[model samples]
Target: MNALYHCISKYHSIPSGAWDALCKTLTKVEIPRNSFLVKEGMVCNNLYFLEKGCLRGYYNLDGKEVTYWFGFEDNFVTSFYSFISRKPSVENIQALEDSALWSISFEALNQLFDAHKDLERLVRIINEQYYIRLEERFMAMQFKTARERYEQLIENSPHILHRISLGQTASYLGISQETLSRIRSQG
Candidate 1:
């Protein structure tokens, strides 16, 4: 798919043969809204690349679902700790809408990575990107006002407000729904 090609190209130049080989391992899947891709306590064996729709990763905290991140079209979503370590995940990955995705099992991906060093490079770059985004989010929560954080969220993912539920958005922004409502009204 073009999304896969674009992602690889953005991270590093891959040989055509290697790209094709990697693509072959990916399988297309269609998931319904509200379906769980990775449930808490289950090992996440697959890395999913969104072809359409959206997904959210959340953790249950004090009987509340606190969203950590969202993935939209052309983005990748996975319980990285679970996938890499082959351990149970603490987060739940759920579809926000009916979605299509390309997924490859962790075993298959590791095999491909072993066969192609360039794939390892691409994976490292992607991991670093994820880390940077998480760091930015942490800093925003610590230092930025709620309104500023909301504004930055809009700048980073313009369609997020439209696509995800307000409850999830509030969780992601680490605000109460009422607070998010006030921020939205004041904006």
Candidate 2:
């Protein structure tokens, strides 16, 4: 509710009327710990607002789960390529804890975008922000030292150490649990 409104307002100046209409279309869902919000090979039809709890995006590779992104409270969580392309998701978005989420269907969002220019602009901004963050993560993995990547992750998500498991955090940083342990000890 308020979190959704705040997220939208952070990017654009939307009218109360638009928020009222948007609220009418949004559904609140509770996901349990260790459950998948958007499963791999399933089409992601809705975009999620992470009102509470945490979600990690991961995919299987070489029989192992590789975590790539973690969405925390107030962040948007969705398999964007799947959501936009209307294809099955390659990654799984999993709840790390009991979570409260607000979801809007693809059709409902399109309708809102058609009716509200502000909301449309907000969506564009959201896409651009996601792209920029993704680029940073990719460059870090390809070029930055492991320690630098770990430091950047800590700077980007200050509460991540408290909220996330070390193994998952290590995977996101493209490092091993032993490496993470060494890094933690060095700190």
Candidate 3:
């Protein structure tokens, strides 16, 4: 809960009453390794704050899963497009380890947001942060080599190498396992 509080406060301040109300909507969950929080073609109605463990978000392309993002403790993960559009998600978010999460449904969150303008502003700021991250990722992919991307990812999330398989790490970096191994050796 403190993690969530800090994450929100990083962007904007919320009234104490609104924060308390938002906390009431959250439900803590334990998810086992290899389980999906959201599967392809299913609507992602909940947003999750990962309190412990790791998760990966991937797209299924021609029967192969291509990893794009990873989430660890103190981070949030959701199929944002699916949640916002009320449509089936195209990607899968799965637990990479046994995980602890606090989740709130879209309906619950929207209701809270409606009742608290300050909370809505906080959420807007949060969305802007995510958008900025997306843009940075796009720019990195456009201009950075695979090794450079790997280095940047490590600099950003140093624990990732310990939490993921070489294949998963390689996929996330859009490189092969051999390439990742080579990069790892060099680093």
Candidate 4:
């Protein structure tokens, strides 16, 4: 609940009444580690606000898990394309640790946004932030050297190295585990 308030407050000025109303509509749930929140080929019905622990979004590429991104506490996780289009998703969202999350179904979220213009604005800002992060990641993969990427990852999320498994970290960096190990050793 505090996480939602913090996010909304950070993105837009929300009236107290609207904030309370939105909070009332949210459903809080605890998910076990390694459980799928959104599986490939399923429509992503909920927008999750992570309050504790971590989650990852990944896709299968040539029988290998290629991680796209990770979401930690106070972050939002969703299959944006599938959620917005109301179609089946190609990526899978899994809890990396036992997590506490507040979520709302697509229908409920739409109703809230319709009822509160500020909420809609907040959603737009969040989407923009997501897009910017995605663009940065794309550029890093395209233009940055492997060591540079690893350094940037460490700089941006120092805890990731300790929190996530080496294999998962390698996948997220678009590198093989052996290469990641070499990068780590050379540093």
Who wins the lDDT comparison? 2
Local error of candidate 4 at residue 59 (angstroms): 0.6
lDDT of 4 by residue, 76-169 (tens): 8899999999999999999999999999899988998889888888888999999999999999999998899999998999899988999999
Model 4 stretches with alpha carbons more than 4 Å out: none
Of the two candidates 2 and 3, the one with more favorable lDDT, higher being better, is 2
Pairs clashing within candidate 4: none
Q: After superposition, how far is residue 187 of candidate 4 from its true place, in Å?
A: 1.3
lDDT measured at residue 104 in model 3 versus the true structure, 0 to 100: 94
CA deviation > 4 Å runs, candidate 2: none
Q: Tell me the lDDT of candidate 4.
A: 0.91
- Models 1 onward score TM values of 0.96, 0.97, 0.95, 0.97
At residue 180, candidate 1 shows an lDDT of 97
Over 113-153, each residue of candidate 1 has an lDDT whose tens digit, in order, gives 99998887888888898888889989999999989999999
- Against the true structure, candidate 1 reaches a TM-score of 0.96
Number of the candidate with higher TM-score, 2 or 3: 2
lDDT of 3: 0.90
